[model samples]
Target: MNLKATIFGLLVFFISGQFALAQSTEIEKEITELSKKKWQWMADKNADSLAVLFHDKAKFVHMGGTWGKDREVDIIRSGGIHYKNADVHEVMVEVLNENTVILWNRITLLAVVGSNEVTNPFMVTEVYVKEDGNWKLADLTFSKLMTRD
Candidate 1:
């Protein structure tokens, strides 16, 4: 009787652990897809698409602190940070929960200003949350690695 009970308990525990792992993996994959969609929107310079990805009260810290959506729009419109070319690499995502995610990645930026080509490397951290059945970026932070010196 003792042996049978122990075997059944162990089997139940193993199955429960596997179920939890599968759920976590699914959440991770969903968050990763959301991050990819955001990057693609940026690359395409689709302001509307990018806007939808961000929560209305989203905060973006360019290289400093807290830039609002209006400021972001102005920067985009005035060509303050135009991307002639760019690439994202080495992206890693950490899931906080089913609705929250944190991601870090390295991005290379290339911009053209009337024949002058500028290339820069940046490290970025982004946070996203599932709100009202859609994923939206809650915060974005960046460090200008190549421009430090």
Candidate 2:
């Protein structure tokens, strides 16, 4: 009966692993699409939409300085820093748990800072947390890269 029990345990483990993989894949797609929408929203200066997505205590890191959600929203709304365009070259998502995920994006960003427009290649890291059934952005950091492909 020990051999039968071992076989049953193995089957259960295999099935559970498959389920987890499938769930992670679904989350990956959802996050990827959400990220794409976020870029568009930033370009359009849709601060309201972004406000909903960003957590109240979210952190935003930039070349100028690091700030919180409110400042970021205001900057976008006021056009102080206009996100003109974002060309996403690569996207990767890691689901840490059901409630948390981390995403990395390699992008070429065009922005208007004050009166001058500039372009930069960056590797952006975004951390998302699921709260009350909604995925909220918790932290976003931009790391400037030297070369662009």
Candidate 3:
């Protein structure tokens, strides 16, 4: 190709690439919002909505060393992990090439389980994957802060 033609082609390619990246960022943000809403739904014991946000291969690791997808679903069903009051202070998103994203955040959870009241701050991480144009949680992990007496 001629020099001028080559330059124009390169410019167009660069612009389109940038546009695609911007669009991907926006889409990732939307997915993050959806994931947070799903957590809220879980806290509210809205099993139907929460189920929709989890992929078929979703796995969860509790801070207490519990691991099991079926048990996680059961916990949600029985309100075992209900969050009466919680706050997500910060969310950091790492995009893994358009279809996979990793989310990390710090959260403060204050709630009652049965008759016992628990309040703790924790760091949470979750992996989300896009399937058929929707993002769903594929893996989840949480760790609680420990304090010395």
Q: Which candidate is the best by TM-score?
A: 2
Evaluated against the true structure, the overall lDDT of model 1 is 0.74
Query: After superposition, which runs of candidate 2 have C-alpha atoms over 4 Å from their true positions?
Result: none
TM-score of 1: 0.78
Q: TM-score ranking from best to worst?
A: 2, 3, 1
Local accuracy by lDDT, each model? 0.74, 0.96, 0.77
Regions more than 4 Å wrong, model 1: 1-6, 77-79, 111-117, 146-149
Write model 2 residue lDDT over 50-91, tens digit each, in one string. Answer: 999999999999999999999999999999999999999999
User: Per-residue error at 138 for model 2, in Å?
Assistant: 0.5
Per residue, candidate 3 scores C-alpha lDDT tens digits across 28-61 of 7876787688668867888777677778778887
Give, for candidate 3, the lowest lDDT window spanning 10 residues: 140-149
* Colliding residue pairs in candidate 3: none
Q: How do all the candidates rank in terms of lDDT, highest first?
A: 2, 3, 1
Give the per-residue lDDT of model 1 (tens digit) for 101-142: 888878786765335677778887889888888888888887
lDDT, model 1, position 93: 83
Question: Whole-model lDDT, candidate 3?
Answer: 0.77
Q: What is the lDDT of residue 25 in candidate 1?
A: 85
